[model samples]
Target: MYSSIYGGIIRHKFPLYKPNVNLEQLFGKHILFLFSFLTHENLNRAIRGGALESTRDVTIANREHLSDYLKVRDEYLYELDVHLDRFLSSASKAKISSPFSRSALRSILIQLTAASKCKKGTLRYWPSAGPGDFLLSSTGCPTSAFYAVVIDQELSQCKEGVKVITSSIPMKPPLFATAKNVNYLPNVLSVMEAEEKGASSSIWVDEEGYIAEGPNVNVAFITQDKELVMPPFDNILHGCTAKRLLELASKLVDQGLLKGVATKKLTVEEAKAAAEMMYVGSTLPLLPIIVWDDQPIGNGRVGELTMLLSDLLWDDMVAGPDTQRIPVPYAE
Candidate 1:
């Protein structure tokens, strides 16, 4: 459970996401669920957190698959489900307004995949609608409603390398940094701010000079010893994509590809001298950061490990262990 700086508290689980806060300020009816599906190529990776609810659109492979990775997630989400409403308070946001539950997000992915009719681009489980702010309304729907749109698959073409810049942007403490919240102003601005500076994205930092995370993704790298290093999960978020990347990377240890995997406090200075660097997250799995503030990171190109790790994750999405791949029951 993470608390928003706006006196809001977010609870996570499939089909049941509730935010508790003062609706008196911002009408109780303007909110949406904060969840999205992560797909590889065109297949869904049924990775969830906090609450895992049942859906009629898709079927779990079996108890074994659930026990493999989702077992812990289920237990965690169940506890959140039972006490969802209990979080209601003045310090929390005041609504749950998504058109579909977390389960529906999964179900749609199944329905799409079962049709064998995917466009071969990419499919995302973003909310069909999202809440809007005071900045811009009047386009078509509620500034506070959720809408999902299909887009051309955006695979990074920066095979040579991509340039990244560090930002001095102060961050808003996420309501639940772990839970995916629909409110992402600070996140968006960081990126826009980065683009204005001719950089692709921004790396946010705290007042203490410690590296926090990327605008919308988690930061990770390799050390001289070949350790897959990520920052501590305290200030940053626990991303579903990042988790899967680590899981796949763990497998490479035995193959003598990676020395080990770990999470530690990473500073910018330490990062500049790393063996390799990449931004890990959903939608865009692992993107290599070749340059930070004009300094070349590792060999200044996408690392060999980065591609292998990406393939492992992509392969897992297409060919799952039955548990990882849910049979999306489509209506024939």
Candidate 2:
């Protein structure tokens, strides 16, 4: 339950409001679960609709309680000053180590739904690391860019497929690579190096030259015999799109269209020898890789299995069942 101000989050003090602190009351036969919303949308919603009903009137009208709350808030802000002071003097990078977040995208989607209804199409926040229960507060310099990909236009559509390079720097420790981290200084450099060498993307190779995954996506390869092989997830950031694509391929396995699915350490030679190679992530659900460095993989075009998986993924996203989506709860 600690808030990290290392990323310039605390300009003054943070409004670290205290929820119910009673042990017995909180842990009685009836358990009390709480969620905190620290976004502007949430605050506005509370005012427009209604929120914290039980404490709403009291918080606004009670002079003593209001004074005390304001005092505590100011005190918290002062503490932020102290922390910022020490942090600035410290040399090493500061990370806000907290609990591993669950359902982060889920919460964002809910807010996104609300945003859509309000016609407030933009929301901004600085990324932070910690276990979060919905309440988030952070920002960075307002930055925008004209992001464009310099795809190898010829190789992109080449049924023979695109070229990929092996990464010189291996992935970080298991946990660091397993979750999304904001530290992209090294990753950007690595991607640039790969692109400069004429590769569509890069495969992160371990010290022993075993392929872990990719810098931005999870890597997979299909054998000539029609087996889908993925790097072990224990050392890589799990990709949602990859998992869904694999799930959709289960029908293929049942119909004998595919052989099997496996997660194991794959060496560079093994991957290069694969019948087809692909990268899967949220953005590029399934992209093919035909050439690995100087060698050609299989027939050098996107594999049939890759195309099949891509079609299935696109279908699910574009026209999936209503049960798959959460409807926006727009105010009446």
Candidate 3:
């Protein structure tokens, strides 16, 4: 994990307690508070909400922040520029000022990825209002802060289909939904509702009865007429992967594999009648949805074109141009 407060990277294990041996040599006795908070008793208290008033706990406890996720492959960060752009845009919308410049942030992310030696995993980062007193507003924060961590994960193309149900949880307002902030209660509740109903995840429908998005991913469909259609992004999050899919899926149109590619409103009835359905997100890239609300989608099997689109996206992530993939500078 890299913290602007730490001013550098600190190696730690799953529980995020251990500081690197060099910290003692570098900071001497000054960094003792960091270790004190990492102790089992202190962590337990924080987890139990007994220490919610602590300044270091405010960023997460208060839930005033923004975050973004990126896929890392072969020590290469995929679509680094695109993800950074979205992150900065979200920060602007959330009124969170970044402590570092864009170039410096990019360099930090690359260097952190390299330091972790994680060939294939995820890079998750957050910009917060910074540690401050327990208050609803961020006025008490001295300055905004940034933190990022490299997670070791094994992600692959999701070929098999999964089931989903329409979410009953209230969807976030367009203002909040369009921004990738730390407010995800509705998303979590929707996913939980899906699990309770024996489905992988849930979809959110707008108040106007149009498909908004999935719990945390964007939804797309292959229409009966073979058109690749997704809900317009005006009211939902403008997903980077979904946008890329739209761009890459155009190849299918050129090759006569799909009729056309477009983004427009999709009602539940129209979406359910589609020949194929899928969820698009940074991690999933493309996940086929074969069933919704216990009813079969199309032939109740993964669509051939769905796999084709997934392969296109997977290939792009694995071997896309330099513009989309940034090579990480791992230590030799």
Which prediction has the highest TM-score against the true structure? 3
Cα error, residue 247 of model 3, in Å, equals 0.5
As for TM-score, the candidate ahead, 1 or 3, is 3
The TM-score obtained by model 1 is 0.60
Q: State residue 264's C-alpha deviation in candidate 3, in Å.
A: 0.3
lDDT of each: 0.51, 0.48, 0.83
Best by lDDT: 3
Sort by lDDT, top down from the best: 3, 1, 2
Worst 10 residues of 1 by lDDT: 63-72
TM for every model, in the order presented, reads 0.60, 0.57, 0.89
Total backbone collisions, model 1: 27
lDDT of 1 by residue, 70-90 (tens): 111111111111112222210
TM-score of 3: 0.89
* Residue 169's lDDT in candidate 1: 66
Candidate 3 residue lDDT tens string, 1-332: 67776566765433333446444454444332331232223332211101111245346658888889899988799988988999999999998899999999999999888877777888888888887776878888888888787766789999999999999899999999999987999999999999999999999999999999997799999999999999999989999999999999989999999999999998899999999999999999899999999999999999999999999998998898898899998889
Candidate 1 wrong stretches, greater than 4 Å: 1-105, 112-116, 119-158, 329-332
